[model samples]
Structure formats: structure tokens, C-alpha cells
Target chain A: MAIQDIRNYTGQITQENPQIRIRLNEELHPRWAHCDMISRYLGHLTGTLDLEKLEKSEVAELGDSVNYVANELLENAIKERSGGSIEICSGAKGHTVTLVVSNRIEAAKSEKFKASLQKLFDGESSLEEKFFATMEHNEAHPEAKVSGLGFLTMMIHHGADLSWRFESGEPAHPGRVSVSARLTASVF
Target chain B: MNEGNHSTAGPETDPVVSGPEYLVRFSRATGTVTFGGTLRLNSYDEIKSMVRAAVEAIGPTGVLTLDVRQLKLLNSSGINLFAGVALSARSSGTKLRLMTSSEYSWQSKMLGTLRKLMPTIEGA
Candidate 1:
């Protein structure tokens, strides 16, 4: 909410730089549209391109497409990038679409989940196999299910074709799992 | 080696494709299709059949209620099917009440956005 207030303030500061204000606003709230709901407000803040000027219909489609792709990557990222909470970063922007899902997994936990997660992302194993294996692992502990397909629309159907990946220890010293994708009118 | 083509798809992904587990009639006066078990992608086909059957059973003159409380997850395909059905019902002059959380802010928001995007779609 504070971030939204900042955008309003920025617009009031300089009418000549409304575009700048829009850019600032985009950075705080990244594009996220999934099944009529945005899982993350993104607090995207701003971007180089000006999507703020786009119509809601256009934004809705772009948001849906962006979300579809992001969710698929996250499915695998959760298993591979274990040990920390996953969060969508607020600093992503694009006229087409943008998503940055970040997960924080402590380094102290087991990395065994990493290999299985990689297999799923790589397509060596099916989602079903991964789910069973993950479920077995979850039998001992609960709430781990959040890491798998919690918000699916963003991952599998982003834009047109789907893509995903995983990374750790970025920006901060703590481990992080991140996945992102985009879609343009020409590409779809 | 393969489990053959007979393998049932996971019901978790697409609710539209999944088949219904059963059909229960609360009353002949007012028919309701209650989605039991897990309503996932793999189960949608059956569910669709059930929906059609329930609607037909109730006939054009009767009303229907879709209870989604037990629904595990309603995916994109499921939502589309719902929109399609709701539109069809509207044109047919049949009333369908969503016996669900209209007051639930998130669900309402979701439904409202969906209705806006798909103008033909309608519901309670």
C-alpha cells in the first residue's frame, strides 16, 4: 500500500513525467494474471516500456500469458530450490510481460530434492512421478505442498510455449529460486 | 514397459477433462450436481457429462445449483467450461445458482474478473 502511495506522489510531483511515474509504478507491481486473480501484486514498481497506458483487456491477456509460463518453472524450482520461502520479486517490468518468482531455501537443508526437481524441469520425469516422489517426501512433513503447483496458471501456459529454470544465492547471500517469462503479440 | 494408453490422467491439472465420480439427485424438483471426490483435470469429462445429465434431468423448466465447495481445483479449462455452460443456460432461459461463496472476496474477485474478460459469461 505504501508503494501505491509513492506512485501517486510521483505523479503529483511532475505532470511532465507521468511516464516516469508509470514506469515507477510498474516496477512495484509486475504483470501477474492467473485465472482472473493475480497471485502477486508484484509491487513491480516500473519498467522501460509503458504498459500502464495499455487497456485492461490487453493487460489482462498479457498478464494471463505471463503467469502461465512462470508457474511451470516454479513447479520445478520449488523441489530443486528447497530450504527457503519462495516470493515473486517486485522489481520486474515489461510492455509484453514479466514475472520474477523468488524462493528462499535455507542452505542447511538437504539438496536431494534438487536432483528430482531438475529431472522434472528437464522432462526426464513426468509431473506425476515427481508428485508421487514429492508426496512421499511430504509424508514425513506437511506444508511442503506449497512448493508444487500452488499457482499453476503462471507456469505451464505462459505466452505460448512454456519454459522454466532454477538458481540459488542471488542478490543476497541467502539461497533463492527464481523463474520468469514473457509474451508479445507477434510471438503468440 | 509403458502402462499402456489406458492410464488415467491426473485429475489435479484440468477439471474440464476429468469425469464425474457419481451423480446424486437431491430432489427431482431442483437438481444439483455435487462435484465429489477430487474435481481435477482428469475428472472433467465425467463432470461435464454429469453436468449435462443433471441439467437435462432438471429440464429447461427446472433450476440447478453447482456446488464447488468440495471441488479440489478449478483450472483454466474448467473455468472456460463453466462459462460456456453458464452462457448456454442463460440462452436456454434456465436458472443456475452457484451455491458458493459470493461473499468470499477472493472468489468474487476472481469470478468478476473472469466475467469481465468473457462478457458472455454469467453467474451468481
Candidate 2:
């Protein structure tokens, strides 16, 4: 769905509010091309928002962080979804831009994803260290594409706060995951 | 973005994996490579191989300058790939320099961290 339509669902927030959401159903099956389009659109939108609210000097950094975080979140959602749609949301509160990307995943993979997130929280290794470790691991196993570095990048490289929520399966919806990331960028 | 354009003439895999998301150009004479477009996890191996090859080509006491003003989006894996390249260059006694533009917010933010990782490297 278009971002404008999602905005309607989100209700009428003040223009000063930096948050916005875009949702796509499974029928869209947004391929990589679609992902590129959506990312670019959000990047531009977020960049404009930042420019309007923050100093001109901070625009580049803000734009880059939101775009990078949004793209990675969308990529993961599409990769994990078995057969469902995805939702992407973004907004700024104070000096941080909060972004959320969610989708329905396979029941089997939810545990694995959850375990990885837990590792991020409990593991002693730093985000930078974990990033390198994953890089090395990926070399030996070339087939693996999801190296679990998306959240780390947001946290360490891009200076973004990250979180996730996995909803329990219900009669209507099963295996839903919402991944959220927040970055310290003044949009208001 | 052209796929399968990696040249095998260098010591390692071609560092410039030009694809739909991004384009990489290496100037052998200037020891510089320019990157443009989106870089994701799938491009990680190709980039690593390319950096390795570049370092080997430059050898010890050589310099490799990276121009990333045009590279719009780079995922975490791509960041890791560049880190690997920087570390590899540092260990091999090669100097790495990055040229970035203030016009692009991501480059200014990211390249700064990368320069910190490779302290010996230069550029904004």
C-alpha cells in the first residue's frame, strides 16, 4: 500500500511528528526491485523530514541512518516471511528517528530469529566484534546471506537503537514479527 | 549494475562488483576505487575479494583510496566487508584513504567510523 494510505490508518498526527508507515500485503510479494523503490522513497521522505526539522549540517547523517536502517529491516522481513505482507513505519521523537518493519514469518524460523536477538542482548562480544565474527563465518559458509548483522549495523555503525516483537500465533494470524530501530537524529 | 563483471586479472577477486544496486570503479594507476549505488550482503564476498586483490596489487607501502560519495545505501554486511578490507590492508602494510562528500549524509557518517577503524587511513 502507498504510504499516504497507511498514514490514514495511523490517524492524523501533527506534521511535526516524524513517524510514518507503509504496509504491503503478501500479494505484492515485493521483490528486490520493489524493495529498492520503497527504500528510495522512504529515504527521500525521511531526508526531507530531517532537513525540515534539523540543521542543514545534520541532514546527511540523518538521511543515511534512516535509509540504511529502513532498507535492512525491509530486507529481513521479506526474507523471513513465508507468505504474508510487511509493514514499515518511521517517525521522529525528540532527537531520534524510530523505524519499525514487520512481517509474518514461518513458525520454524521464529525461534531461530528470537535466539539470535537474545544472543545480541546476552552475548559479551561487542556489536563490532560480532559483526567481524559473522563476516568470517560467512566466508566459510558462502551460501548463508542473512549474517545477522542488520541490527548490529543499526546499533554500532549507524548509531541506532534497535528492538523487536514477535507475536504469538493466533487463529487468524500466525508467526508475526515486528522489528524496530531508533536512531539519534533530530527531526523535530 | 552489471553482474559477473569481476575481472580476474588482479591478485584477488575483482573488488568492484557492479550490479543493479551499486557500481564500483577501480583506478589501477591512481590506486583509487569509486563506489556508487546500494551495497548489500550479497555483494560482500565480491567486495572482500576485490579489496584483497587491490591490496595485493598495491603491495606493501602502497595506497588505496576509496571514493564513496555516490554509494547511497550500504547494509551491515557491506560495512563488515569494508572493515575486512581495511583490516586486511592495515595488516599488509598498505595505506587506505577514503574520499566522501558532505552532500551525502550516509557517507559522512559511515566513512568517519571506517576511518576510525583504520586509524592510519586518511580522508573525510
Candidate 3:
């Protein structure tokens, strides 16, 4: 396959200036627990921002959203990656908090991912409908592995602006996929 | 896993499924399954059997109330599991009631989605 660099953006495009970047390599065999720990840590770190003016509930909500988004992104990376390190970058600029997670995936899987994204971005069904439909389908089919609900939850419930970058056709690393989720600070 | 039976007047003991970060307790007397702590299991399969067992314990009659007020976090896999449980309860002609905490904004949204899946489900 020829080298292909595909970028798809949804919602709003913001500047790429991340405040914190954490990389987890597959070689170290990162456990599932790490996802929870890292997400909680990020939540605590993000919760401290603008703490004086915000209500306690608002602060908690902000932390929860950050934690949830970060965990979902990290979990997806760990589950889908074929190999290589997973890089996660998070930062807040103005009213938006951006989280980008990148990992190496199999070329074949990238095609499937693209198709899924098409459904998310281009399909006639609203995101709410698609989310419930996906859940119903998964329930009907017990053997089906992927629910595709994580992305939907982030988009529909958390109001996350999501985008993707797929890079392939490289000699050293063939397939790399990066997912960025931008959440408005006030949405929480 | 530590099992703690709820102190209730019944011959049947309540079922408690617990991990380091999470606890799921099903009280037979009240027909309520209370979930607490964070549930971010890597796969739905990890939680499938436990949740299914709770449903089975609920039997085929009366309403099943899932109290998640104390639940701190429920990942997508956990959502899927709960969705499946809701579907099962609906198909079995059992009323389902979800009690969620307003402290977590996501709970309301999640309840809305579950209601869409099974409109008969009651959210409190």
C-alpha cells in the first residue's frame, strides 16, 4: 500500500499546544490498571485548574470528564495497538481541553477504523441513535467483541470534539493512528 | 473477592461481587443491586458473568432496581454490561429501575440512552 496520511476533523480545530505528554510503551507490558491510575492522576491534575472560581460540583464534574475521556482514549489505544509506544498528550487552551493519543496499529485494522469513523461522521443517523443502535446490536450478538460505545459516549455524553490522523506507508513504522478529543472546559 | 450478605430477614443470602476498586451487591430482600466504586475492566466479558449472575438471582418476577449512586466510574464496557442487563430484564418481562446520583452528570445521560434502548426502564 502506498503511504497514506489521512486526517479527519470534527467540531472545532484548535491550536496544537499540549501541556502534559505521557508515553506508555508496549514493551513494558502496561497493565489495565495503569489506565485507571493515569486517568485519575490526570483528573486530579486538571481539577486544580481555576479551582477558586468554580463550584465544588463543577470542579468535580470537570475532573470526572477529564478522567473519563483520558481513560477511554488510553483503553482504546491499549486494546487496538498492534505494537509500539502509546503517546498521550493533554492540555487546556482557552475554553478547550485537548487530549491526543497515538499508537501503532495494523494496516488492515486501520481500514476498519476508517469505516467506523465514516459511520460516526457521515452516517445519516444521529450520534444518539447510533449509540443506542450499537448497544442493541451488541446485545443481540453476544459474540461481537467491539461495542463502539466508548467513542459515542465521549462524543454524545461528554460533548467531546473528536478527530483522527492515520499515517501509513513508512519503512520503519507502517501504520500509526492518532486520535484527538477536544472538550470544552465549561461543558462539564 | 469478599462476599458480604446484606442484613435482611431472608433465608437467601445477598450476592456480593467485589474487586479492589469496585463492589456489586445484590440484595434479595429488596430486589436491588447496588454498585459502588470504579468499574473499568478491560473487557465486558470480565464483568458479564457477575452481572448475569445478579440478574439470574433476581429471578423472573418483580422489579430489579440497580442503585448506582455510589458508583464512581463505569467505563464503556461497564455501560455495555448494564445495557445487556436492561435488555435481559425487558425481554424477561421484569421491570427495571435505575437509581443514579446527580453528582455524576454522565449518569443522567447514560440513563437517557438506556431508556431509549428500553423505554420501560425507570430512572430515579
Candidate 4:
């Protein structure tokens, strides 16, 4: 099969040096509770950042944002994983905190994920409009499988920069995708 | 108001629903549904059902106030659940209000977005 790679970036530009990396094995069948635990841990770690300029309340807010972003990313990864390990990396530089999560998915799902993301990144609607539309859609159709609210919340509510990279055709790992979210320390 | 824990009862009886990390209790006397603790459920099914039941109990022409000041963390799924509840209340001509705290920025911001979506959903 031919190799395929797709990338999309949005929001502020920042370089990342992931200081912490964790991998969750699919064999263990991690539960949803694990996502909450990991996200809380990340939030605690974020709170400890030595950004002296940030006020105590600002630091707390940043930590909460990190926790929310991490939980959403990890939840999506775990829920959509296709028999491979999920990797999470988190770090901070200056006022920006970066979190990246990579997981293996079925090759076929990559297109669907990319399309959903395109709607988020390239659609003509403003983020707020798209968010409300998505919420209304979900409300009207309770049985819809995908809500598409996670990324929107990360961007609109938390003020996080979001990006994604999808690759396929590797011999050992056919479908691998990574999503990165960068958050500024300042409270929104 | 009826503060005791009650199962999914009819419109007259107060319902107190508990999840792994959260509890949602509706006080019929006050027309308020108080959500306390973190709510990061993997899927929206559980929270959706609980919220739907509570809203249904409110019935048409009734006021439904969501007191989320105590809710610490509500994931995107949970946010979506509230959005659905708000729309439902609007369609049924039920008055909806959200009570939030500034301490939890996410809660306030999420509720603010919902308020913007549905202008009738008052926020305090």
C-alpha cells in the first residue's frame, strides 16, 4: 500500500520538548477511570510549573486546562484505539504547555478522523458557531456516535492550539496518528 | 426541600442520581438540579439519561435551574449532555437557568457558551 501522511496545525506557534512520556498498552484494556487519573496527574504536574509571572489563580487555571485537554485527548485515543499502545507526552516552555498523544487506529478510520478534523480546522464557520452547531446536532440526534465537541472545547474554552499528524503504510504500524495541543499559561 | 436520595421517580418525587465521580440531585420544591463533584464520564449515555430524566420530570412550563457551582470538572461529553438538556428545555417551553461559580473557569465558560447558544437559558 502507498504511504499516506496528513498534517494540520492551528493556533499559536510553539516548540515543544516533551519532558514526560507515558504509554498505555492495549492489552491491559485501560478503563475510563485511568483517563481521569492520568489527566489529574498531568494537571498536578502543570500546577507545579515554575512560571513566576503567573498568579496563583492563573496557575491553577492552567492546570485545570491541561487536565481537561489531556483527558479529552486520552479518552479519544483509548476509545478509538485498534490494538496498539497509546503514547502521551507533556511539557512546557516559557508560557506555553504542550501535550501530544499518539495512538494506532485502523487505516480506514484515518480518513474519517481527518475529515472530521478538516471540518474543525478549515470549515467556513467560526469555531463558536461550529461548536454550537455540533452541540445542537448532538442534541437533536442523541444516538450520534461522535460529538466533535472535545477539540472545540480545547480550543474555544481553554484557548489551546491544536494540531494533528496522521501516517499510514508502515510495515509494523500501519495507522498511527498524533494530536498535539499547546496552551499558554495565561488565563483566558 | 426534599434532600433525601431518591431513585428515578416520577415528576413529583425528587431524584438523586449518582455516578462514579458525581451526583445529580433534583429538588422539585426549588425547581433546581444540583450537580456536584467531577463528571468526566467516558460516554454521555449515563449522564444524558440522568439529566434527561430530571428535565422530563420538570415538565412543560416548569422552571429548571441547573446549580453547577459545585461541579468541579465536566468533560466535553458532560458539556454536550448539558447542551442537549438546555435545548430540550427550550423546546418544551421550560425555563432553564444555570448557576455557576467563577472558581471553576471551565464550568463557567462552558455554561457561558451554552447560554450564548440558547439566549433563553439564563445564567447566574
Poorest 10 consecutive residues of model 1 chain B by lDDT? B1-10
Interface RMSD of 1: 15.3
lDDT of 2 by residue, A105-182 (tens): 766787788777667767688777776576556555657756666777677767776666666675455667766676
**Backbone clash numbers for all candidates listed:** 46, 7, 0, 0
Q: What is the TM-score of chain B in candidate 3?
A: 0.83
Q: Which tens-of-lDDT digit does each residue in B1-124 have in candidate 3?
A: 1123222323566656667777777777788889888888765454566557667777678788999999988888788888999888778778889999988777897898788878989988
Give candidate 4 misplaced runs (Cα > 4 Å).
A1-17, A50-52, A170-172, B1-13
**Every model's Cα RMSD, please?**
15.6, 6.2, 4.2, 4.2
TM-score, structure 2 vs. true: 0.78
CA-based DockQ, model 3: 0.51
Cα error, candidate 1, residue A156 (Å): 3.7
TM-score of each: 0.35, 0.78, 0.86, 0.88
What TM-score would you report for chain A in candidate 3? 0.85
* Stronger candidate by DockQ (3 vs 4): 4
The alpha-carbon lDDT assigned to residue A24 of candidate 2 equals: 87
Sorted into a CAPRI-style docking class, model 2 comes out as acceptable
Alpha-carbon runs more than 4 Å astray in model 2? A1-19, A47-53, A125-144, A170-173, A186-188, B1-16
Flag clash pairs in model 3: none
Predicted candidate 3 versus true structure: per-residue lDDT over A93-183, tens digit per residue: 6556677888888877888888877777675888887888888898899888777889989988888888887777454565888888887
Give the runs in model 1 whose Cα sits over 4 Å from its true position. Answer: A1-49, A52-56, A65-87, A90-95, A108-113, A123-155, A160-174, A183-188, B1-30, B33-124
Error of 4 at B93 (Å): 1.5
Query: Which of the numbered candidates is closest to the native, going by highest lDDT?
Result: 4
Which whole-number lDDT from 0 to 100 does residue B80 have in model 3? Answer: 89
Residue A28's C-alpha lDDT in candidate 3? Answer: 78
